[model samples]
Target: TTQPPLDDESVYRIFNKLMLEGKVRAAVRFVTERGGGGVLHPSAQAEKRPPGVTLLDVLREKHPPQQQPCEEAFLPCDSLPPLIDVDITESTAERTIRSLSGSAGPTGGD
Candidate 1:
């Protein structure tokens, strides 16, 4: 049996699933290859694999999530800015704070 062409909702669902699984390149590929033409392979990687495995499943599993979310900084610790010790509570504005607009007090009209 042949699979029907994917609709917008189905396309979005597949794309989101790949993205959330942290497979950006695969997600883009899926949209470009499958979405652009709706030509899903009849049986991508069917032989020598599990019964229900799919192309998307293989792409997502190619890279583990634990290894995907790190910045590309040479010295990661040095890239971060130092924390500020200063405190400014909104309820009690610091004395140094001044209204950016007209003076908080009434003008000469006061």
Candidate 2:
């Protein structure tokens, strides 16, 4: 059987499994530039890799109530920007539309 394409969800599940299997160091490095441990926020304490403790274990210990069901992850380029910029000039917009139409196919006006 063929393997499914490695989409974001698959990547996330694989990472979670790796972390659960005591590969937290590898998991963190995959998402961040820091290795082993690092700071997540300016005010937050720096992460420490305690003996025999995984990052996921630490997180669950700290925020048991906030734990959420796993969802899909995505590459940075896979999503659209939160905000969009468009030129509001009517002439510019019209010109762009006309140009696109010209390239799409022959028009009846020909």
Candidate 3:
């Protein structure tokens, strides 16, 4: 069924999960695919950091990619990303529920 587009919370949630799971590469890729454009991509830089790359880890502690380096890197602000196979929770509002079941949006007049 259809759902609403991704929001800042959605992006941050997924990003946080990936970081906690130690899926640094996956997190970077996820952000990139979402709208990060790659230059400001988050990096464990495992090779560059030489086993002490805790940038994402540190950011994980800060959270939600707001007013931070990691946030600027991969967190999109200008545009919405294309929906991926994200495990969307049942947080969608009533409008989405209605639309998915084929009900149109509100009519202008009864």
Model 1, TM vs. native = 0.30
User: What lDDT does each candidate get?
Assistant: 0.67, 0.60, 0.64
lDDT for residue 49 in candidate 3, whole number 0-100: 50
Ranking by lDDT: 1, 3, 2
Badly placed stretches (over 4 Å) of model 3 are: 1-4, 34-110
Error of 3 at 48 (Å): 31
Better by lDDT, candidate 3 or 1: 1
**Per-residue C-alpha lDDT of model 2 across residues 1-110, encoded as one tens digit per residue:** 99665778877887798799987766766555444442344334435764666556666678768555555553446666588776689888666666552224234231
* Per-model TM-score versus the true fold: 0.30, 0.23, 0.28
Clashes of 2: 0
State how far residue 66 of model 3 sits from its true place (Å).
Answer: 40
How many clashes in candidate 3?
0
| Pick by lDDT: 1 or 2, better one | 1
TM-score computed on alpha carbons, candidate 3: 0.28
Q: Per TM-score, what order, best first? A: 1, 3, 2
Q: Which run of 10 residues does model 3 get worst, by summed lDDT? A: 101-110
Task: Encode model 3's per-residue lDDT on 1-110: one tens digit a residue.
Answer: 99787898998999999999988767887878743332333555533454766667656756765554665567557978797886656666554655542124444221
